[model samples]
Target: MSESNTPEQNSQPASATPPKQESLLANLLINIAIPALILAKLSGDDWLGTKWAIVVALAFPLLYGLRDFLQNGKANFFSGLGVVSILLTGGISLMELDAKYIAMKEAAIPALLGIATVVSLRTRWPLVKTFLYNDKVLDTDKIAAKLEDNNNLGAFELTLKQASWMVAASFFLSSVLNYVLAKVILTSPPGSEAFNAELGKMTALSYPVIVVPSMIVLILAMVFLFRRIGKLTGLKLEDIMAAHHR
Candidate 1:
């Protein structure tokens, strides 16, 4: 006869299964391509109509967020926020207001992130570290040891905080560009084919229009950061950037 089972025995199956996670490209397709496609191809006076198309298109992103929550028992920050943004964007579009509301929705996300980046400086973990210095890009452990060896840790942290301000500036710049791009391109009243077509154009142009410039700023931040790190640690630039190659 078997011995009496404990609660831990019964819970093993649930805990042992690996969680399902969506791929980055899949997530982007769900969020950006699906919505843009539905709006561009289906949203028109003769098709699903603007209101219904927007509602239907919005469902794809919401489903992505729901899937994330179900598997992990929690939502990813960007994923959850993407779903909420879609809801707000859809709701605003359905309000029969001018096109500017959509433009505002587009701008609000980056603007808020910029504000949060500035606010995070007051906390223990500055957002700059995650953006530019995390394990994926830069090895904090190796740098920490180097800093301790050289007695440069304090100065390094100070440099990171200063870099965070520049990061915030880049985000604010993107926020302004986002608003202006939407206004200039999204002139057709919401829900029309012209509107949907323009939306597609904006989506297509975003990489070149907004992302390229923002990346230039982020690249500059990385350059300034590495240069400071080298100065503080007395390490060669190649030695300091070994974190990236590894």
Candidate 2:
């Protein structure tokens, strides 16, 4: 008879390894730089022209997002919303809608996010937990244990709510800036080469004008939450932060 296999040999792995994270530099180049360049430089009669340029420029982000979802094998809320936002942008530009509609759309996305962040507080999972206190960034289990031992859970909850508010505020600020920037940079009528180039300029400027300030606010909120966690749990920042983060 054939020899029986050992249990170890028979056992399958519990799960597949997680997908590798994408490079930040590559993400920026594909999502921002490439699209900006295409729209600004190629939206002319000799090249792709205005309408075709919008299609080609938007295609990069659409495909990149799809690739990211396929690699991760899961869809998060923000990623879904991003896909929708890109679709709306392409639709508006292709239809040759007024620039004001584009400005409104720009403001609406962040405004909706801000409202959602605030509303999530009423549910079991607060947005702050996702953004600031998740296992990716913090030793959440250890922090929970410490809070339990010190009977500081109540205080921790309150502090977390405050952080959530700060995050919402940042989203609101982004909404305002997005509208202003779109309105300021996008003046030419849609379907024109001038309009396409202006859209490209707006896309390129968005990082420094809106994204940088929003990131600063988010960083401040994270710092505040971490400090409060330190105080409540009597743990040092390095101790509470995840090993990878540390």
Candidate 3:
């Protein structure tokens, strides 16, 4: 005979699904290209004007961040910083502040990250692991197990500490580049059409100027970490990397 389940059994919570990953193209278009285009092309006397243009350009990133958070069902450190950065930019432009403030704002984010990356080395969790050596890209659990078996776990930690410094260097590089780029590009006074166009120019240039160099350093750091992991654990690169990457 078939039996019916109790209400308690039937009311069990559904399994939680993984958070959706943001697409790189969508992120770039929303945060960089579209905003830059709007600020550059639309910020004119006949178009959106200085105030409205800043508002509209900043809105894309703000809305995109909100949507990403909603899709993930949580907040992240970088996303929170992005929101703060947007607010600061909007506030400065709307208030017609000095152009230097915008440059400082651009530099501050990466500077803060560089400081945090250095400081986190003293703690149990290093930012290097979060950025490079994490399970998202590496078979961390397997590597850890192998390290333990080989009595190289302490050695691995030392290697991670070195890699953390390298990561910090990348952040510092980005911070310097950001400041210089901003100081050079954002010369026009804030809340002017010329200033808006300059802001757009800075945005367009930032990817190739600041981001690419920082990314190269990060890639080098990752390679260094992987090589050290292989030496310590005697694992092949194919085995060291996560299944998805392989």
Candidate 4:
């Protein structure tokens, strides 16, 4: 006879063993420092010529992204987007374009993304799920069951649509910020040391400039959503949010 593991033996609590979170230092070093340093120090110099140096600098993020994808067995949506953006930047740099071109380039990505997010709302499976739902973040199945039991599924989905609109608006805000930041910071010609330095500066500032604000918006959206869920399903916040399990 085979024995099945009891909940006591099988369960691992989220609080007991916290998920390992990425560190700020690691994020800075890998995402900003390594690429920025190489570009600033060697990009405009005669070492590999400006063109190839840009390529090498671009390679750092690409290699890192590829390694992550291979290790994870799939490229994450954001990482894949980052790689595409890197390629675009590299191409623009190699073209010997002016700073405004780079500025336009920088803005293009977020603008397109913002547009896409809003457009996706029209589809059956909205892209909000990628940002908000999924097993890693919350147990959608459990929430759905609760909603069904409470006869609040329709109302819950409408609430999600409202939340999704707020999210789209945040992306649009990011797009404007991205454009302005790039336009202001990247004032030197591409392939110049000053240009590379400005690029470095842009990378360094992006967290405070973009990420912090975006996260605040996201948190507000989450709060709004959970509050509605609480009202509709009459579930505690903890009950609606997934339990940490191992």
lDDT of each: 0.76, 0.87, 0.86, 0.74
- lDDT for position 67 in model 3: 84
Q: What would the TM-scores of all predictions be?
A: 0.77, 0.90, 0.89, 0.85
- Per-residue lDDT of 17 in model 2: 18
After superposition, candidate 2 runs with Cα above 4 Å error: 1-22
* Better candidate by TM-score, 2 or 4: 2
Whichever of 1 and 4 has more TM-score, that candidate is 4
Model 1 segments beyond 4 Å from truth?
A: 1-24, 69-73, 234-245
Which candidate leads the pack in TM-score?
Answer: 2
Tens digits of per-residue lDDT for model 2, 1-246? 012244432431221112223357767788789999999999999999999999999999888889879978999788788888889999999999999999999999999999988999999988888888898778898999999999999999999889999999889999999999999999998999999999999889988999999999999999999999999999999899765545
Taking the tens digit of each residue's C-alpha lDDT, what string does model 1 give over 104-156? 88888988888998899899887887788776555556677889999998898
The residue-by-residue lDDT of candidate 3 on 1-246, one tens digit each, is 012245533432222112223367777788899999999999998999988999999999999888879978999889989999999989998999998998899888998998999899898888987898887678888899999999998999889889988999998999999899989988887889999999888888889999999999999998999999999999999998765555
Each candidate structure's count of clashing pairs: 0, 0, 0, 0
Residue pairs clashing, model 2: none
Model 2 residue 88 CA deviation in Å: 0.5
> Judged by lDDT relative to the true structure, which candidate is superior, 1 or 2?
2
RMSD of 4: 4.1
lDDT of 4 by residue, 1-246 (tens): 012245633454542344344434555677777777776677655665567767777787788788878978975988898888888888887786777766786777767776777788789877777777655556567778888999988998788788888787777777777788888888887777777767877877777898789778888988898788788777777776654532
